[model samples]
Target: MKLIAFCSTGMRVAAVAAGIAVLTGCGSLPLPDKPQRPMVYDFGPGLPAASSGPAGAPLALAQVAAPAPLEGLAVNYRLLYAGSGQQPQPYALARWSMSPAQLVSQRLRETLAAQRPVVNVGESLAALELRVDLEEFSQVFDSPGASFGLVRMRATVVAPLTRGERLLGQRTFTARQPAASNDAPGGVKALTDATDDLARQIVAWLAELPVPQGARPVAPAARP
Candidate 1:
């Protein structure tokens, strides 16, 4: 009797173990983890908006007279591939795989014309050339998401190539703006603001500083 009972108990244990193994193999005993979504930036929260500035204008600091009249001014930009220098780099926006030269140039052009009083490079065929080489244009987002941007650049006005006289004194501008969001729209706004902020800085700089003589000062662009 004792032998029979012992064998029966052993057989039951073996059966249970086998059943467990089968269940596990079929994943019946192994529940899957909960499905998860990838992280993304939010457009709300600390992100700034177009109206963030006064009367829908971007944030502005100081506005002074151009050191001298860019009277004979003709503006042209390079909008080159900027390396790592500032915040919210457009390249970084796209995972640092592509270049944002065109976007940056467009933004710069629009901002200079709309925000401040500068000579038109095209209509006038002016003498001085304001050259800008963007060194860095990127954003930084570790864990808080893409919330901050930096724009590093170098600018100078060269006298007509024939003159070989670069403007003396001051001719450079830079700006940084942080973008933070828990979402997507916020990230873009932050990026936009980043661009706006930099533009304002550049405009302010150009406004206050004197332009190198470029075919004598010409009339400002006709008011639109």
Candidate 2:
């Protein structure tokens, strides 16, 4: 009986030792690496206040459409080598807060709202419609380090007629500004400037269109 009890106690001790060894081995194993955080950027406050233009009827602005790349929030850059074709690349660690198209639309709406009543495409009482197609929004590197922010978009204005919606006017606007640095922040700054310029141009263009009959009149100028 004594011999059997001693053997059972030995076995229990061995089992506990094995369990301790397994736990120690687990503690020594390397842990998974933590993920790195990416830098996010956004266009600063939209372009300076454009000259107040005569407001026409309420205008509806549609969501801007862009290519697959510009439609994302990634910060994209283009390398313009002498031989290589234009292939855009996104920065691995840098990104935009919102897609370029969305940013541009926001800027346009804010800038235009200062001068006239602006509404979305689905608004019930919109008198005129504005549509924009974004072609390019990228930082083009001329050489290894030199770069500029380029923006190109086509704008169309339509007015509802007795028959149907009639195309009032259409135009393409382009703006390029030299980047202050060869980094994402610089690119964002330049792009914001370009967007502001585009907004000003669009506002001017809308001002020249003849107001339709029964359209709302321009809002009274603000008191100084």
Taken over the whole model, the C-alpha lDDT of each candidate is 0.45, 0.80
TM-score (C-alpha) between model 1 and the true structure: 0.45
TM-score winner among the candidates? 2
| Candidate 1 lDDT by residue in tens digits, 1-224 | 99999999999999999988888776566578987643333222322334332221221111222212111121111112343332221222222111334344556655665643334443343444455555544444544433455456566544433433446334455565655553434444555576566666766665555544334433333321
Off by over 4 Å in 2: 1-34, 46-54, 214-224
TM-score of each: 0.45, 0.75
lDDT of 1: 0.45
The global Cα lDDT (0 to 1) of model 2 is: 0.80
